[model samples]
Target: MSFARYVEQTDPPRPPRETLPTMYDLPSENPEEPGLPDEFHDFQPELLRITFQPPTHLPEQVFSASDMNLYYNVRYPNWYKRPDWFGAVGVPKLYEGRDLRLSYVIWQEGVSPFVVVELLSPGTEEEDLGRTKRRNDQPPTKWQVYEQILRIPYYVIFSRYTERLQVFILQAGHYQELNLSESKVWMPDIALGLGLWQGEYAGIHRLWLRWYDAKGNWISTEAEQERQRAEQERQRAEQERQRAEQERQRAERLAERLKALGINPDDDL
Candidate 1:
């Protein structure tokens, strides 16, 4: 089917929620899928979601998901892609501004992802990087869905095993690999930069793909921010205590000097 025709029909979509399966009706997962969420898969996306704050968008206008089924086609309502993590700006935090989304239906939502991240695993490395070919009947690979169908602005892949980061941007109607300096790429549209940071996430000390602010500071997780605030408070308290102690010592010296000069230290003025 032509893309134009798909659009014509989907403007008042008949194949998605009203006529065909919606997120609530569609099955989210299959045990047969090659790549499944492991420990890192769980932690990394959580970190991404927490740290992703677009300067231009409101909190309600930005939404991020991990391992959620993203249905793209109105023609093929069952066709879906489960990106490791995807962020969409200018979309409701809930499905249609009220209900929580069980899955991200592109046709229904009427927006493509701003950025999609695929956490590479050994089992799915070939397909994740667009190396493997799909049979004619199979749904398009993750690359085709994100790059061609969805036309997502940014595509990112990170491998924990090798500690490598790769970013691709849609250019000239195709994805072009971007040259990264220090394993970092800035998405100006999103007003955020992503890079590899050597630090502890969820108590695991390793190099991880993390988001950075415009100043090149790693966006802190909520817990990390809380810790930083606590530290600041402690430092301020310590400084105040030191100042009080110094004042007390100075007052004692003045009293001693007055006593030596035959003037009672406690005398009324």
Candidate 2:
């Protein structure tokens, strides 16, 4: 059935949108699921969000969040997965383009995430890699949902401790792991690439996964761009100061030559 048919609410007297559990009503966090508790989780995903600039999408049309509940199943609306980071284009940054989304409800939004990232931690490593088996009565595993159900185009896993990046792309209705011959992998669909870079982020110097442009240049954050501009301005000012000093010295030498000729240096003034 079409997603619109699932949430059809034209009958006025009782609109399903109004009656259904909106993001507001759904539980934000599921304590039963194993959660990755690390400060790296906070910083890495934040960097992804800052540099996630999709050339084809407007700023308001791009939406991404970390550790946010993503409600995917219409049958069990309460079921959700909190990804380390997930991003989608062609969706409003705000829920319904007005309110902030407490959770991303697939039926209501009608858009599945284009990419989902899982930061590897010891607790969730097996499941994140889709190595765990689920019983018939149990809810589907993360891999099953992303590959067989949501069919997210790109699934990324980054390890902070190992600084390893493993990317899987959906092909033929299944995820085929891309060979990471190098540290970087390009996503032609998104017109960007993800790579491991050794740099200082959030005051910590280490290899962090970040996005790069089609030209293979790392995308700069707003703050990083601002700092670069300021440094350029400073260099320009310094060059101007040096030019003025050279002109002043030339004038002094001309004045000395005029004095030797017995001509008043101030006469030109």
Give lDDT: candidate 1, residue 209: 81
Residue by residue across 207-226, what tens digits does model 1's lDDT show? 88888999999998889989
| Model 1 spans with C-alpha error above 4 angstroms | 1-17, 34-37
Candidate 2 lDDT by residue in tens digits, 181-218: 99888887778888898898888998988889998889
Q: What is the lDDT of residue 122 in candidate 1?
A: 75
Residue 180 shift from truth in candidate 1, angstroms? 1.5
Residue 179 error, candidate 1, Å? 1.7
lDDT of 2 at 109: 83
Clashing pairs in 1: none
Give TM-scores for every candidate, taking all chains together and pairing residue i with residue i.
0.91, 0.89
